[model samples]
Target: MQYLESFYNYLQYERRNSSHTIVAYKNDLRQFCEFLEQENIELWVNVTSKVIRSWMVQLVNEGVSPRTVTRKISTLKVLFKFLMLEDVVDSNVAKHVITPKIPKKLPAFVKETEMDFLLDSIEFGQDFTGLRDKLIIEIFYHTGMRLSELVGLMDCQIDAGNDVFKIYGKRSKERIVPIIKELKVSLVRYLNERDKLFPEKRNPYLLITEKGLPVYHKLVYRVVNSYLGQVSTVVKKSPHVIRHTFATALLNRGADLNAIKELLGHSNLAATEIYTHNTFEKLNSIYKQAHPRAEKMEDYI
Candidate 1:
């Protein structure tokens, strides 16, 4: 547990990881610690391959997704590796523990036509809240910002003249995403309304509620969900889905994967590669439709 505390401190201060990522790692480690405690195991040296595998099986039995179990295994492996580096443990039992294979899932996205209708129908003049929500949706779709990065946005981070906004991503890393021309126009319109709502305050957030308070995560989620529900019948209509829509749309239009990775603030290409599957599906459909020999000849026979 003491080592966990140290790891938390390392993540917060030294690694400068985002609070969300730190929380996830902390939770994963906590679950592992609780499992060990229940079995009367203490100290990193007491961890064994069999105990690790059993914990994984228990998680699966409790209906945890294979992806989640894999992540937990990764968390433990990293923790023990750190301990081994510090000579806190005699061996890395977690090293020999294998992660369960997870099936690749396609990223969900709204159709471009549907997204256009949703954005166009938003009545920005209805109220300050309406204006704010409109801009929020536009930014999410245009910029592909993670929810945390979008919520963490400050007013000073935007360089409107350059059409770019700075974001603080995971690990407190900084990246600049360019604003599309349409988004810039929409943002300027929102700013006009925002100024009327908060005439005197100097808060740095671009989006705020009617009370001039910076937007919170749940509020953003609700706004995204409500608007997406109007345009989509899909069960999972959230901000991340909008972000996915943005990525897939770009990839479909021939944007470079590496460029998209940077824009989306992905730490690795693997994280960004999911969109390729969507692109591949699109290509396959086109091939089936346009290729003369693509159709089966058995129907004619």
Candidate 2:
């Protein structure tokens, strides 16, 4: 527990990690420590491969997903390695712990036709809120930016002349994502209404509520869920699904994986590769439909 307190301080000051990431790390480490306590284990140096394996088995028996168990194992590995470097542990006991192989599940994405219908259902009336929501959906689908990145955007981040917006992504890394021409037009229309709503107050954020305050995650989720419900019957309708929709659309249209990686602000190629499954599914469907031999013909004899 003392080590955890030190590690948290290290994360906050030394590593400069984000609050969300630090909180996840804290939770992971806390759970591991709790497991150790439950097993009557003490002293970091006494941690062994056997103990870690037992903990993993216990997690599995408790109905935790393989992916989650793997992540927790990864967190322990990092902590043990850190302890080893600090001389608090004799060695990294977690080194020999094999992580569970989680099955890759591609995120569900909305089809292009469904996306079109969703956008069309926005009903671009004279109402400022409707126009604003439409622009919000368009920007999200077109850019594939994380919800935080969109909400944290400032007026200075937009390059109106070039039609590109700079976003600070995970780890405070900045990337420029281009706005499509149509999205730009919609943004301009929304801004016009926005000015009418808050003519006296000037805020840098692109999207705001009727109260002229910055939009929050819940508001964004509601906006996305409401529109997606009208267009698709998918059970989960959130901003993340819109992000999946954007990634799949790009992959289906033959966009480069590396390009998408940069656009989506993925630090690793593996994170971006999930969209390939969607692409493969599309190709497989086409192959089955168009190829004469894809479906075996009954024996002529």
TM-score of each: 0.68, 0.69
Model 1: number of backbone collisions: 1
Q: For candidate 2, which ten residues in a row score worst on lDDT?
A: 292-301
**Which segments of candidate 2 are over 4 A away from where they belong?**
1-100, 122-124, 297-301
TM-score, structure 1 vs. true: 0.68
Question: Clash number for every model?
Answer: 1, 0
lDDT of 2 at 161: 89
Q: Highest lDDT, which number?
A: 1
For candidate 1, write residues 1-301 as lDDT tens digits.
6688888777789878899988999899889889989999987788889999999999999999999998888888778877887889877788888877898879899999899998886455656677778888999999999898888898899997888999889999888999888889888878887787678967777777778888899999999999999889877989999999999999999999999999999999999999999999999899988888778753675
The worst-scoring run of ten residues by lDDT in candidate 1 lies at: 121-130
lDDT of candidates 1 onward, in order: 0.88, 0.86
Highest-scoring model, TM-score: 2
Q: What is the lDDT of residue 249 in candidate 1?
A: 98
